[model samples]
Target chain A: MSQIPFTDIVANLPASVPFVGPEQIERERGFTFRAKLGANESPFGPSPKARDAIQTAIEDSWEYPDATSVTLRQAIARHWDINTDNVLVGAGIDELLGNVVRMTVPPGGAVVTSNGAYPTFNYHVHGFGGTLHLVDYRDDHEDLDALAAKAQAVDARLVYLSNPDNPMGTRHTADAVADFRRRLPTDTLLVLDEAYSEFAPEGTNPPVDPSDTNLIRLRTFSKIYGLAALRVGYAIAHADAVTGLNKIRNHFGVNRVAQHAARAALEDQAYIDALKNEIERGKRAYAEIARRHGFTALPSFTNFVTIEVGGVARGDRLLKALQDRRVFIRKPGVPPLDRCIRVTVGPEDQRTIFEQAFAEAVQEVG
Target chain B: MSQIPFTDIVANLPASVPFVGPEQIERERGFTFRAKLGANESPFGPSPKARDAIQTAIEDSWEYPDATSVTLRQAIARHWDINTDNVLVGAGIDELLGNVVRMTVPPGGAVVTSNGAYPTFNYHVHGFGGTLHLVDYRDDHEDLDALAAKAQAVDARLVYLSNPDNPMGTRHTADAVADFRRRLPTDTLLVLDEAYSEFAPEGTNPPVDPSDTNLIRLRTFSKIYGLAALRVGYAIAHADAVTGLNKIRNHFGVNRVAQHAARAALEDQAYIDALKNEIERGKRAYAEIARRHGFTALPSFTNFVTIEVGGVARGDRLLKALQDRRVFIRKPGVPPLDRCIRVTVGPEDQRTIFEQAFAEAVQEVG
Candidate 1:
């Protein structure tokens, strides 16, 4: 039988997934995790109002969601005090990352990102046949200055940075970030990912001028509003960037429940404040646990905490040991950072379970 | 201010929206339709079990959905008695259509579809810079023989056909479709969109055959399953096509609620039977109404019925009149078929409202 032929680019691309979910791990191992803390999901759950909105919208699942997502975008704009014209909502920051890459990057086009930054963004750049220039992180944070310089040197079309960074939970101060943005080449667009911005220190996120045409800031309901499963995220950019997104985005990509739920979640400020407090409590508890276990907890501005385990091999072993004891956690893949396991803040119960598992894993690995 | 430059293809493409959703129309008119018959939605709602699943999963909206879509794909595989390797689920048929087009159509490649067939498929083809070859419908049905000939003549990379066709609500027997599939060139990939398959008469859908290497069948929960708002759909093809999708697909595109709801919907055969019966009743009622109004109702295998309004101008006038009466229905865009207006089957109450509105619109247009 003749086989179906794929495009040369698709044929050459590897069948790779960015991150495997905990459910897939369980399915493969025939064992479920006792504490599902690996994926940085908010175990505190979505707002009660968001849940109510989802339930109310259940019966209307027969209709397609509004293509423009007008209400949700308006709500997001009001919350941020920005114009709706500057906001573009998508499935998640992940999908938005894919879109931005597809828009600017062509075959052999230059794009720059940190070596150990968000892999999904790199995956998208690769999928679109772009040449990726990787810059190494400095002092456990995304080195914005180095990224900007590299983009200039390579004449990159795009540069990516995630503030309140993942895996290491490190962040650059607002002034530092603003300085880096000003220093970047005018032609290169900066993708400032603030997925964890809500949990960052008050002044950690720079007050980006919406009129700044060269930068786009991505934020997510996944982290702060606690609606990751609904998959809603937005990018705040100039009107041209937003309009350019319309040229390529899946217009009705946002789900109806997501739209309603995200709007409600954005309105429930009290719920967000309460969740923030809970996350702070979890972070402190995790730091205490790390101190008691003889590991050094990295200074963090986000919900997750990362602790140094002295060696990458030892960190991997400890992570495996935690999984073996029914606790799930993830460590960075690159060196220096690979010596640490990143744990997201959760409810007291899951945190306690993670603490006990971490102690046991540390002892075993040691 | 300097503007970020887009890729050559992106710069060359026109700013176009594929479809104008009914919600946009309602927003612009500042009036809600009393009888919402456009967009071919089920209107009967999803299965009871699916509704319950969505409600139960509401609280877990903070967590990301399983990236693999394991449970839903497993259920789909079992339903078709095919291996899991043959199935790949996505946000919806719209997304899958885009993916298929991207992988098959290099820039300027030829794609074949009927003149006024599903515009979303055509939109995807255009989005990927594919040249579209349109064949006119024959006797108000998609001309399968003509489509095959066009595909051969154009050396098309992809040929799209919607069984139990949209806009016209017409279909051919399974044998005729299978014969047409056999006549297509081996190099041409056939995208058989069966979005309305569940509402089709018996023998309308070809038997599931995973060994057909050149054929890929698209199915959706939007129609018979009534989960359009949830945005879940699947493509069943040979393993090669299924595997190729991974290279370009958004891995976490399907929402969690959609996956759970679709799984529950697949298991609720009783609910599906009831929905099918309701649709049949609605179809008969519509046909009776058409006869009473001196219009001819076309033979339909799908959930909607298309009625001839004499000519293109009459059809346009009738549609406008219906809209003025706060009833929303759609007509095909092409010449001969434009003489008809298509109405979807809704719940009993909505259909009664539509019946009254149809009478008023006909009298006014006359």
Candidate 2:
């Protein structure tokens, strides 16, 4: 018998995952890594209060989560000094991106972003049949002007920008980003992803203004709160935008324990402050390590740093050597950025292990 | 400035939740529920081993979940005697339904289901711009023949059937369901939601047959495994169908702790068997209560039963009266089913409280 036919767009989509997880790599290699620094997950775990909340919540696992996620949203709204209607919690920023793409970009609609921005965003665009327009990075930073210009040219429905961007830990100033948003067409929705906002300078992010219907800010507990495994992220946007997202999102997608833990984490500001300090210390140590090895460490405002290797091919060789020595790290696949390897800041012991592995890999590859 | 425009599909869709959670109702009413039995979530709770696994996994909450959900899917595949590729894990059956609708239903595509089968599935169908054709229930059971006929007439891209149907808690035999599948058009994918299968009698659900390209069977850890709050569900289908789902699913939507807990829950079959016996006892007690109240109880094959009141208006009054007394429960909205109140079987203490509340509610409403 003939097989069922998939919708035209899905039938044509390639069966691909945006990123290969470290666990996938371990399974393939038949061994565990000595230092796991690939995905930029926080080496320092979640706040103790958050951990306690999750342990307590395990007994209630038989109950369905609140479909509206009212408590968590209210907490997030308080954090931003906005109403609960302005916040929408999802399983993660990834799920919110998928919903945003579906709600704003119709099939075959245009979307614009930096060429090597978040691949998962691109995946959602493709999943929804939105055409993506890529603008190349200029001087190691996302070309905001270029992105705005292309969105205008294509009449794009959505444009994405990440502050303290991934793959390369470069950030544009708050004023620069606000100016970029102002330059975009009113019809074009600006997805301002601030997953690393907590790590960046306090003034690096524009103040949360839910009055701007054309912009939505994405934040996550996955980074500073150190709850990536919990899969909790949220979007702060205009009330109307949140309503649009609600119409299409899976109502129960956020886990119950996640909602409780995220709220607990949010309440522990002291823990987050301490975590930032530790992250700064790790960044400084990484920069010193790079200086000792005669390599350039990119100025980073996030928890990870990009160390410039010689070239793309050399970077690939170094990455392979590091993998062989049981150190897991990732690199950008796009051209100029491919010259560097991205390493997440781990705890002291893991950082020391990464340093040793990095030195050996450089020697062997050279 | 003008607000950004939502996509046509989302703009036209209602910002409505499929089910109003008991928590939402409690918040609105300003009181706690005496008996929390509204959503059919397991009142028995999850296996102790599953709770232990979640507690152990809490320390690793900083890492992202395995994007592939490899271990959980492998365990599910083993349970069903299928290859790993035949299993697709999702945050919950609700999320899997969203992906299925997106993959099979083009804009304005036809879909068919009972009028009140599962509001969440209907929500997804509407979210994707699929036109749903409703088939009314026959004798409180989903009219399988009518559903198949409607699919044939509408050339539906998808058709949904929930064994041990929701709202009414009635079920059809395994052979009858298989025959209905055989009758559907090959292009019309059959979405067999077996969420309550564990509570159902043996042979009530058709065996897993991943070789059938047109059928996808959805099961949840939410129901019998009692992990609804953790939000893990899986689909057993042909490898090609799994590929189609993978091309569009949120890869990291499933929580890390949820995955581990679900696997442990799956391994504890002895606990499940004991839970089943306890549920059966609860069902018997519920039936006796209904009889004493001079109401008819529908023959139930799941954890919940539908108690028939005199009429729709009476059912509404009873529901309201129960709410006023702080006993949480739900009833169907459509005409025939609306004449009945659906109550979940809870633990002995909760059940005793519910019985007293029901007696009071009946007296007050009458």
Using all chains and alpha carbons, the TM-scores for the candidates as numbered come to: 0.98, 0.99
Error of 2 at A279 (Å): 0.7
As for candidate 1, its clashing pairs are none
Off by over 4 Å in 2: none
Error of 2 at A344 (Å): 0.6
Report the lDDT tens digits of candidate 1 across residue range B163-204.
989889999889999999888878888899999999887799
Q: What is the TM-score of chain A in candidate 2?
A: 0.99
Write down the C-alpha DockQ for each prediction: 0.74, 0.86
Q: Which candidate is the best by TM-score?
A: 2
| Whole-model lDDT, model 1 | 0.88
Candidate 2, residues A1-366, lDDT tens digits: the string is 757769999989999989998899899999999988988889789999999999899888999999899999989888888999999999999999999999999888999998888999999999999999999998889998899899889988999999989879999999999999988887889999999999999779998899999999999999889899999999999999999998999999999999999999999999999988898999999999888888899999889999997799989999899999899999998988899999999889999999999889878987
- Segments of candidate 1 deviating more than 4 angstroms: none
What docking tier does model 2 reach? high
